[model samples]
Target: MAGTAAVVSFGTASAQTAPGPAGTAAGTTITNTAQASYTVNGVQQSATSNVATFVVDLKANLTVAPLGGNTPVSIGETDAVLKFTVTNNTNGTQDFILSPIQSLLGGVFAGDNFDVDNIRIIVDSDGDNLYTAADTATYINELPADQTRTVFIVANVPAEQAASLATVTLVAQIAAGGDVTRQGDALVSNGLAANRDGVVDVVFADNDSGFGDLAFNGYGRATLAYEITTRNVDLSIAKSSTVISDPVSGITLPKAIPGAIVRYCLIVRNATTLTPARNVNLTDLIPANTTYEANSITVGGIALGDECVLDGLPLSDAGGTVLPVSGITGSYDATARQVRVTIPTVTSLLPVAASFRVKIN
Candidate 1:
């Protein structure tokens, strides 16, 4: 084996002659040119020579095509067609990789659902008449330079997920010469941005016991119960009533007989982790022969005063009561979180029982 020697030099030299007889000197100027070359595998190759260097932008551009029609696709539903195109801008061929950074159907409200599947890709390029699965990866793949490729994303919106509105984002990237360049992500709208405003109705079941006949010095009292029911959602009772009353029997002396008074009480509680503010109203009807009587009603341990009687019964001062039992209506107390209503006693006519309804707001 022979050793290798390398030579490196700089600058040029010119020859000069010293002055001869008659003090005259003659000289010739010489021009030298220097060149550098490189060799690989014993073959000499010309080096790149340029006064100014040009830059090639190897970034990829991605854009989404508008969705076709007005077919509503809900959450948890799949195969919804999404169209998009990708372009490479570079002097030479470049390869791009594409993938989803986040779930397209993420951030859905409770009870909302969606699905994504069935990805398809089409590429326009030369030198490869045939396309392979490696060329078009559904979720990830490489794209060639100065070329355009089309990708389809199928998404589904389920009925439960269809109620609330949401947004999904998709992204793609490219790399060249060990350097990576990323394209901006695209946003896809699910079109469910409005409030659903679903309402739930309250169902009431009644269990009432009759008040027996009252005599000269005897009075009867009855107990009534109500059950309210609702599915998944909370039920609110706004107002209710039982107009029927108990009839009184024969009496001897015309003494002062206290009229019938129906007292109402309401209890409300928060059923869900998300606490709700509620307004409850209770109303009761006055029965025949029964005068509205003044009485006390208690709610959540709060004692209601004589003013609790509604609709002008000779029980207490008729106006400006704390519990406003006037006009067969009463409002919910936010601070107390309960509702109480009382009816005043009336002059004895027949002593009958009355029914009423409660409303929750």
Candidate 2:
């Protein structure tokens, strides 16, 4: 324990004291000179022997790198991971308690999206991005000096969650068991400075002992985000038609032929599992050989007198000329010769149907 040991440099009584922060780390080596006596040539002769040497051990330094960016999450998603990193700046092994706090309520970024539920912290033991319960750890243990560890803050996103931004902040504190800046500083060295922010990093002797010891340096912080976005919409369109009659043969038969009335049905459904598809619009092209029957368009099984006629009700003060209805509305592009069905909204389970009859030439 560097934290609990006296860090003064080793030296002879009259030697100038070595300069350093303290704890375990010191100068490269300390050497001592001693005189040896030998009966040389019958006269007692004293000779200086080789120097005794001691080598300096490791030094402690801890620094946590700042987080780079925010995590993007989609609505109806689960188990999204927010990543961060922790580094051991010391020269020896260290242990750090890991803590992740969700942005508090009423806070700036925390104000939106409220909170990300079921938050869990995980350490990447194998250097892989995957997070497994077997790899979960509450604190960083035995992290070698100059080494770094990636951390994950995983959470479950609600399926119906709105499009919003969420976030979480992480903090790392040394939990003792590393190199110390000063002999006595290590006394309370575990979790160095106990979450010190304003306190100076260097500790000095009251009487100017010349050796300014750096306190156990174990404090770091970072913040990440969950950039929640709109869930993907699973939309599908189905087109089908039925023949009613033909004018050439005057055979009111249900077979397709020239001059036959073909009723085309366009079904637009939001096949999503948990979200609503918005502003859904369907488009179809009318062939030059066929002509669109007037006042033949209907939406949701109701006859539509005009484009804006939603279930026989005028969609707006402008009337049904091009109004929205029953979460559905439509328009016919006379110039482009295309029929466009505009759906105001569509749910996961409720599908909307629009139909119109086209007469073949």
Candidate 3:
């Protein structure tokens, strides 16, 4: 009798890359067969063993991570974005349902004292990290295994939320994948159940996220803070008048008489700290029965004691001047009988003055 030998060959079905043993795709069939060949009476003969097969199980996992540390916002600001990244750690294609939760607990960030307004959840459709109108998908679509997508939590800052901080959390839940046109149902894990042949079994392997999201629940979460960096400025205006000269007295206790030249000063001050007043425009209607003096409009003047010295450049009544003050413009409206002064900014408690002269008619 001659020696007999048997050979076995194992074949695994084609599979997509996934997070599992040998990176095999879920529901893929692995087959193995044994063949025996031997010489019987100097003739060659062959026999084959039964084929055995098993399917790959599914591993459902995902994670949500904040892309940036803190998002700085301003009071009354709109469309402020807080970015995060969603990664599909599942063993197959998966969809994710996104939820943005406002955290009242302040332990996530220091000084979490407020909540943002008009909160919205958006997914990045174009792979760009920035938030825009084009990024309109509300839920994560079919994301392949080991792929990551960016998401945004947009909100509006309330007008009263000044110098306040708020915290927000982004939560992602694993859902059914396969359809590209719509979101699938939320996935439920089949825990420690017997693996069925040719059927994909679900297993949750995600770790417990520190932000109140538990592990093996097919869910993940991350938190971020929105900080108000700039404070709202408080502005107040004061107007005063002084008689420069008159027909009766000149530069000395001048009375309000005919042909008297009266100088008016409009001062604007910002009382808030850490923020400056911008685009400050001052308008004053010329007093009745008075004529505006030609080239008497001056802006960016300083206040000395109780007098407004026209140390700034003078502007004509028509809004033109040979020399213009820095970031200051003055004009007189002929029809409205008003004096207009535009100051670019007022930054401190020190007042900025807009001065003009009118003669009693």
The model with the greatest TM-score is 3
| lDDT of each residue in 1-361, candidate 3, tens digit only | 0111111111111111123322566777899999999999999999999999988887787767778667876676678888888888877888999997765344445566788889999999898799988888999999988789999999988877444777777888999999999999999888678777778889887756343555578877767767788766778888889888899878788888999999998878888764566667889999898998877888667777546866456766776643544556778898998888877667775678778899998
Q: Candidate 2 at 215: error in angstroms?
A: 9.7
Model 2 Cα lDDT, one tens digit per residue, 80-104: 7877777665444667777766545
| Count of backbone clashes, every candidate in sequence | 42, 6, 0
- lDDT score, candidate 1, position 344: 32
Off by over 4 Å in 3: 1-22, 42-44, 103-109, 161-163, 233-361
For TM-score, candidate 1 versus 2, the one ahead is: 2
1-361, model 1: which lDDT tens digit per residue? Answer: 1111111111111111111111111111223445579899999987544443222221222222222322233333334434444443222233444443214234322221233343333332333423444443443234443354554443443334223332232233333322234322222221224322221111111111111211111111111101111112242322222122222322333222342223432323223332222222344343344333333322322222322223322222132233454233233333344333432311122111222222211
Per-candidate Cα lDDT values, in order, are 0.29, 0.56, 0.76
Clashing pairs in 3: none
Candidate 2 residue pairs that clash: 61-89, 61-90, 176-190, 176-191, 308-320, 308-323
TM-score of 2: 0.44
Q: How good is model 1 by TM-score?
A: 0.25
**Model 1: lowest-lDDT 10 consecutive positions:** 218-227
